[model samples]
Target: MSELEEAPPESGSLAELARKYGLRPAIARPRPGVYLRQLWERRHFILTYATSRNVSRYSGSALGQLWQVVTPLLNAAIYYVMFGLILGGSRHIDNYPAFLLTGMFVFTYTQRVVTSGAKSISGNLSLIRALHFPRASLPLAYTLQELQQLGVSMAVLVLIVMLTGELPTWSWLMVPVVLLLQTSFNVGAGLVMARLGASVRDLNQLLPFIMRTWLYASGVFFAIHDKVVVSAGLPEWVATVMYLNPGAAFIEWMRDLLIGSHDLPRTVWVACVFWAVFALIFGFWYFWRAEDRYGRG
Candidate 1:
């Protein structure tokens, strides 16, 4: 007989019985090689599954993908009224609507990743428990769905710009590069949230409010540069903290490309790229550390 079969029953627990002899727990050691290979072998399965989910989820509605455009337009209108008309802000920034919309678009991508990743494992608990594939794939597939949607949103923005007389410039070509960095940042944050929020459900609820604060502090709806540089009483540490925000780096880099006669320091672009890479590495490690636990309830 095998060592496990020959083991003596000890105490009341199966774990104790197994441990009393020489048997190890079944779930304790998953086949990492098989797990990774399963992910690669089922790439097509993942792609098709993710695509169908995106389509059915959005297309089931009456208006269909029209909500994509409607959602942002409504957001822009609200911000215009609150920050532009009532408070009479954005006077310091040129093409306020365009500026606000660009930042919102970028921020929305990250927000989607964070919120969705946070709920991915919990929402698909059955799949996680039953399936033997990499848990990382769950968060990754969710991020991919958002990326597809973001592409549609970007196309809408391009059309809006054309109608509003914002012609594409040579600098517009740099958009894809900036977008790549933004996506990297999202993937990183998404992966981290998947594990963190799975361990603690509270992270999911707290993320949105944190993101809203991040949005305002990012200088999307207003210019904080002059406030940072010229205000004599402002502490240097405060300005440094503002500069460290990844959203702020992304917004400033985007404005340099989108707005004419405006340019950001090279360091800003470097900062965005740096943080994007940083987030990706940190998030991947954080998520992977709990790989085995993810399948547990």
Candidate 2:
């Protein structure tokens, strides 16, 4: 046989040997711990990106960052008019403006995070292609951006609550705890939407409607406990399920802390903790699974 034909089989065994000896893939999927460490190492970049984006968002607006507070305030006014006055949804609630605005501010934070995160990866294609940082940074930075805006809006919310005759109490200390849990939940939601939006471009369009439905169902403008559970005569289990909604749970926690609402179910606390932990774990794994595919298209 010719020398070429006499050579050892270069197809299967040799290919395996070559692969075994070759340099490791530059973009191979990382172990979970390693991936998390990489993300932590890049935290500064995430913060800087978040800060810059937050500033730039309002750079052109006439009122600048004031719009953050004003936008939600406007929504609260409309809801107050429609749901509180026109629809009589606030008939059973005391200090309906405080209750309505509390829910609006808290819920809007998550809404913005989810919607912005859905576009984080797809919107930052250029940055993803140009940078070697962890892809998680995009969603993380976006969430941080929303968190900062929420912080500003929250200051205004506190003043609004004061104006509505709700004064600070010892229970207000729990605000930080609730905020921590909700931030965890928001980050996870953002990560999940980032992956989904990267794969399904239409998700960006669908999120607004989905969030609106979620807002109403979350009892933003009315007392869900009174309307759904007590007045409507929902079954115990059904009311329990509604109380378990993460959005409503967070809002309930805030109302309890800020407005002295004493009707919060203990189960809402459990649901808040469960959703925060579950979402973070599942969302991180889900987003990391497709890390290598992010910028391919």
**RMSD to native, candidate 2:** 2.7
Q: lDDT of all the models against the reference?
A: 0.77, 0.89
Report the C-alpha lDDT of model 1 over 1-297, residue by residue, as the tens digit: 776586665557777767789897544534556656766887777677678778887677898867766787788889889987787677766777777787777777777788888988878889878866678788888888888888988887777655655778998999889889988888888888888878886886788798889888887676666556554467766666776688888878777787674558556788888988998888877777777787575
Show where candidate 1 strays beyond 4 Å: 1-38, 227-233
Candidate 2's C-alpha lDDT? 0.89
On the 0 to 100 scale, the lDDT of residue 66 in model 2 is 93
Give a tens-digit lDDT track for model 2, residues 176-267: 89999999999999999999999997987888899999998898987776787788888777767877999899998888889875478889
Residue 248 shift from truth in candidate 1, angstroms: 1.8
Candidate 2, superposed: residue stretches over 4 Å from native: 1-18
TM-score of predicted structure 1: 0.85
Clashing pairs in 1: none
Query: Which number leads on TM-score?
Result: 2
| Candidate 2 TM-score, C-alpha based | 0.93
